[model samples]
Target: MAPFLKEFFPDVYKKQSEIKDSSNQYCKFNSATLTMFTSSLYLAALLASCVASYITKAWGRKISMLTGGITFCVGALLNGAALSVWMLIVGVDL
Candidate 1:
């Protein structure tokens, strides 16, 4: 969590120093950026699941799987290369 916050969210990373005197790490890092960082992945997964059946039916199984795999790979790569918070939200994959 600290390293993640440090990379894309330096502003929030500054707040981590407050944890040095206590064990309430969870409470210390519940910033809005953290919420979006974690929740975006779940939201993306939900939307993908909702559309997956339709995509699978519209295309053949092989095409559907290939498309899904390509999309997942691209999303993962984008997430891995992200340098900003908004980029993370846009490309977050599970």
Candidate 2:
């Protein structure tokens, strides 16, 4: 998924640059920023999985699955509505 997102970075950056003010840092992210974004997601997912395992053990598979589904839906909505690069990152992190 991270690799897929990276593949679209150029298009995403172009559109974001067009929509945002020229001075906005969000519109100026370079390849290093992309690497950081992907790395952050990888780290967050790793930590979340560790915590989710405990929640699943305590709550059972059904509850865990439902919680995950709801969380994913909320994240998708956030990502879809994001107006800035930071918001998009937050949404993806969610």
Candidate 3:
């Protein structure tokens, strides 16, 4: 996904390249920024799962499912309307 984003989004790819080149820690590796950014989704999902489990236990399954569905739709809208990589990241994180 990181590689695909870099290939398809020129603005994001360029910004990531600049950031990577400027950061000493990531300067040694190409696509390091994108790799980290993409990998964060897994972490976000893991954390969201824990929260969702609690929500389900407290609110009931139906409510929990509806909330999740609504959240997903909102996140999709945010991602679709993103104007920059940061916005896209925020949307995906949501």
Candidate 4:
């Protein structure tokens, strides 16, 4: 969390690192952004899962799995190459 914050939101990282509170370390900056960032991935997974069986049935299990793997790889690549926080968030939500 610290490293990610320092990489993207440097100012937030600097201010957060100055805090004496250890228990609330990861969330001292912005709860809303943190919530959205963390929750979006789970929400995306939930949405995908809701349609996974239908997709598998339509495309067959092998093709469905392959497509999912490719999509995961692409999202990972996007995240690895992300230039901004929004890009990172989008990659995560993919």
User: For each predicted model, how many residue pairs clash, with residues at least 3 apart or on different chains?
Assistant: 0, 0, 0, 0
lDDT of 4 by residue, 34-72 (tens): 667778889879877977788999989998899889888
User: Tens digit of lDDT per residue, candidate 2, span 10-81?
Assistant: 655555545646666553555665776677688769877987899899999899889888887887898788
Assess each prediction's global lDDT (C-alpha) against the native: 0.79, 0.70, 0.73, 0.80
Q: After superposition, how far is residue 10 of candidate 1 from its true place, in Å?
A: 2.9
After superposing candidate 1, which stretches have Cα over 4 Å from the reference?
Answer: 20-26
* True-structure lDDT of candidate 3: 0.73
After the best TM-score superposition of candidate 1, give how far the Cα of residue 12 lies from its true spot, in angstroms. Answer: 4.1
CA lDDT of 3 in candidate 1?
A: 85
Q: Write the per-residue lDDT of candidate 1 for residues 1-94, one digit (tens) a residue.
A: 7788789877777876645766554666658887878888899889888788888888868887888899888888888888888888887753
Q: Which clashing pairs does model 4 show? A: none
Q: Estimate TM-scores for all models.
A: 0.76, 0.64, 0.67, 0.78
Better of 1 and 4 by TM-score: 4
lDDT comparing candidate 1 with the true structure = 0.79
Q: What C-alpha lDDT does candidate 2 achieve relative to the native structure? A: 0.70
lDDT of 3 by residue, 10-74 (tens): 55556666563553664444555566667768877987899899999999999999998898888
Ranked candidates, highest lDDT first: 4, 1, 3, 2
Candidate 4, which ten residues in sequence have the lowest lDDT sum?
Answer: 25-34
At residue 91, give the lDDT of candidate 3.
72
